[model samples]
Target: MKVFGFAGWSGSGKTTLIEQVIPEITRRGLKVSVIKHAHHGFDIDKPGKDSWRHREAGASEILLISDERWVLMHELRGEPEPDLDAQLARLSPCDLVLVEGFKAVQIPKLEVHRPAVGKPLQYQDNPAIVAIATDVPLDAPLPRLDINDPAAVAAFILQHQGLI
Candidate 1:
């Protein structure tokens, strides 16, 4: 799948922008998948669920399947965290895969920047950053976008990847 990353500081609207853009991108008759790198502990299974019990019982991989969907949850179990490429290998084929974190990876990236967030940009050292979606006008030579305009940003990403 074509991979793109959204990089920014916490609360800079990276996740929010991706959430808005995914539906619009998918509506254009393309399949999309998201690989979000959680910063802290995240629990998808309920406490009393069978999957939860299985995990608690030391199962490294707990997969739950049904008629419509299936989920494969793998516990790290104190092992080294998987890198971006390794995680990409686990995803099924799709038109695009939007990664929410992993800014250090060399994949093409879009910076979700909000001046109000008061954080420095990650694009200077990251040559893969093709554009920035921001609330304020950026002084850099790179393209800057209004943070509310998800369609425009999504379109830019698609065009930049030559997927449009």
Candidate 2:
């Protein structure tokens, strides 16, 4: 599967933009998968849920399946988090993999930027950033795309990855 990424400071709308772009991409008949990196600990299971109970009882991995869907939750158990390549290997085949974090990883990415976020631009230092999606025009040499236009952003991502 082809890989692309979105990187930016917190609250810069990376999640929002990805959410909007996913539909635009899928509407074109290509399957898409996402890999989001969380800096802090997070849990998908509740305290009293069976999955949670299994995990609390020292289960290293929990696979919960239903007629509709299934999820496999693995506990790190103090194991170091896997790197991007290892994580990517776990995903099923797809047309594209849009990563929401791992800004330091050497993958082509779009820098979702907003000056109002009060954070500096990442493209200056991140050579993997092939373009910018911003609320306002930037003075950088890379292409600038309007953040409000999900279709355009989707197009850019598809084109950049040679998906279209």
Candidate 3:
């Protein structure tokens, strides 16, 4: 599957942009998947849930299933966190994968930027960033996209990935 990424500092609206862009891309008749990198410890299961209890009991993996959906939760058990390639391999087949975070990974990425966030632009340091999506005007060498326009961003991604 084709892969693209979004890289930006926290509060720069990466998640918000991705949330809006997903439907825009999907409406065009292509399958899309997303892989997001969380910087902190996170839990999707409740404390009293069976899956939580299984994980607390040292189960290496737990596959929770239902008619609507299934999720596999794996405990690292002190093992090193798997790399991006390893994570990507776990995904089922798809037409595209939009990655969030993994700024260091060498895939083409769009840098989500908000000037109000007071963070320096990442494009200067990140070679993988091929475009910038922003809320305000800024001078940069890369292609600039309006962060408010999810359709345009989705179109750019499709064109860049040769999915169109």
Q: Report the Cα RMSD per candidate.
A: 1.1, 0.6, 0.6
Tens-place lDDT digits, model 3, residues 31-147: 999999998888899998999999998899999999999999998888988888999999999999999988789999999999899999999999999999999998899999999
Instruction: Show model 2 residue runs off by greater than 4 Å.
Output: none
Tens digits of per-residue lDDT for model 1 on 106-130?
A: 8889988887888888789789898
**Tens-digit lDDT string for candidate 2 (2-93):** 99999999999999999999999999999999999999999889999889999999999999999999899999999999999999999999
Clash pairs detected, candidate 1: none
Q: Give the TM-score of candidate 3.
A: 0.99
Error of 3 at 135 (Å): 1.0
Residue ranges of candidate 3 with Cα displaced over 4 Å = none
CA lDDT of each prediction against the hidden true structure: 0.90, 0.95, 0.95
Model 1 segments beyond 4 Å from truth?
none
Order of all candidates by TM-score, from best down to worst?
A: 3, 2, 1
Task: List the candidates' TM-scores in order.
Answer: 0.95, 0.98, 0.99
lDDT, model 3, position 11: 99
After superposing all C-alphas onto the true structure, candidate 3 shows an RMSD in angstroms of 0.6
Pairs of residues at least 3 apart in sequence or in different chains that clash in candidate 2:
none
